[model samples]
Target chain A: MIQKGMSVIVKTVTKITLGFILLYAVYISLNGHTGPGGGFAGGVIVALSFVHIMLVFGKEMALKRLRSYVLRGLTCAGALIFLYAATVKFSGGCVPFGAFLEKSVSCRLFNSEITLPFCEMLIIGAGLFAIFVALVLLSKSDRYDSE
Target chain B: MIEIHLILLFMIAAAIVAVEARDLLSSVVAIGSVGIGLSLAFLILKAPDLAIMQLVVEIMSLVILVRATMRQDLPFSMSGRWVFNTFSTVLFMCVFLGAAYIALKNIPLGGGDFGIASGVYLREAIPATGAKNVVAAITSNYRLMDTLGEVAAIFTAVVGVMAIARRVGRPR
Candidate 1:
């Protein structure tokens, strides 16, 4: 209907804001242990940033930047990391879901407890991005076939 | 408490406007405002985590909704009036700034004390998980298996979307 993307103003604004959105997402992810946000919240913001890119630059441009396969792989990798962390202790006779590593002092970056949120951040962000790309591409194909 | 009530009331009013508005685009924007109000309410309630999530989720959904509805209203004549549009946009901006001013001016401090169950979690969280954020401790340590399950669920959903969307549906 309208074009591949919006007007010039939207594009310029998006370019300026994209980096801040991404920076905020990472901040939220890293600070999950120290403050208010967690992995899921961070992941959602990450996905939204990608959505913003797609909306302003067109789907083809977005796909060019990050292909669908990469997103899928990232999602799977996040899940695997979480699974390994959860089950790795079973081989040593420790409880399956217990802490995977020694819990360090609070507010530290290397705390083992951050793994779950980190993995969650990866899985939700990449998975949601993949889903959105799929749906958008699907609708495009639908329009072409019907025409 | 009063601040929370006022934000809630504002949210309710915006929701009513969203439902009753004649223009689909304005309605969608109104609904977005309601979400912003709800996020502000969360902030007042001292749940910064929820507030951040709500604000981002609201933004993402609003973008998607606007994209979906924009095509349907392209031919509408009411949107063509530049003067009225300018006036409405200015008014909206003024109202938004006013609300933001009030919200910023009245933001309360941290939520009072932990409740009974929360009291125990607050005490035990650091010792158990060595994490300062109690919510993060519960999610990533105390209830980690659930987080695993959630990840699995998200993975399954993405796979399903990929599987279903790959089909071209064109007549062969």
Candidate 2:
């Protein structure tokens, strides 16, 4: 169908737009330390890409391709990973969590001076996955009444 | 200075339009645009972290509101009389004038002593945390507890969502 072809074109354009947004989100997340963005901003940027994709391709397709359960698992896994890192740091005399990682050299991962990036990556990943799952679920449930 | 005023005016207009718009969806979009504008204003005020946070939170809130409101039929018209509109407009103007007066009278023109400690924190965070990003340093180190609490809050939100989405007497 000609309509189907138009939809395909629209989908392709949306995908390209989302790809660019994803790159910017990663850039913002990584550069958050020195600049204005961080895990939250980066995560939102990435989530917006999924939103665009869903809007263009339809929720059913997105649910099939992006798997709500997988996103839910990713959200939990990312949060657990971040919490584990914080807990380890907290138990290592880093009172409050990430203290050793922050004002001291004794808690550096791999004994390197660059643990913030790794920690940020964890936060960013967790935030992104959590937000994505929430959006997907909310969108899907809004339209179709799943009993 | 002129640009800031222009943007501020635009923000006010957009907000009013959002409140008065007949279409719920259009109002939501307008509110989202106002949020973006507010974020840009924060950025211009040299609060990048706050700007980013505001943007993200606003987007999330908008999505949630849109989803919730989509199932309901929103009223398209105001239910009050001309007197109500006039009174509201006068009250808004008075509030705006009061705020402008306070901002002009209390806030300083340049950087003040408030930023000195933050600067010191940034200087110390680099060698202390082995992190090149000062913002990261502040978030992960100096305010570690706050960040942890935020993470916990996010986790709680996830749990809440799952609880809401679960069906009654549904098998796990």
Scoring only the second chain, what is candidate 2's TM-score? 0.67
lDDT of 1 by residue, B50-79 (tens): 898898778867876665334452555655
Show model 1 residue runs off by greater than 4 Å. Answer: A6-17, A89-113, A140-147, B68-116, B166-172
What is the per-residue lDDT of model 1 for residues A15-123, given as tens digits with 9 covering 90 to 100? Answer: 9999999899888987988899888888988998998888888877888999877898889888887777665422332334336543322113223446667787888
True contacts kept of 1: 0.74
Q: Which candidate has the top score in lDDT?
A: 1
In candidate 1 the C-alpha lDDT for residue A113 amounts to 49
Q: For model 1, what is the C-alpha lDDT against the true structure? A: 0.76
State each candidate's chain A TM-score: 0.78, 0.63
Name the weakest run of 10 consecutive residues (lDDT summed) in model 2 chain A.
Answer: A110-119
- Cα error, residue B128 of model 2, in Å, equals 3.0
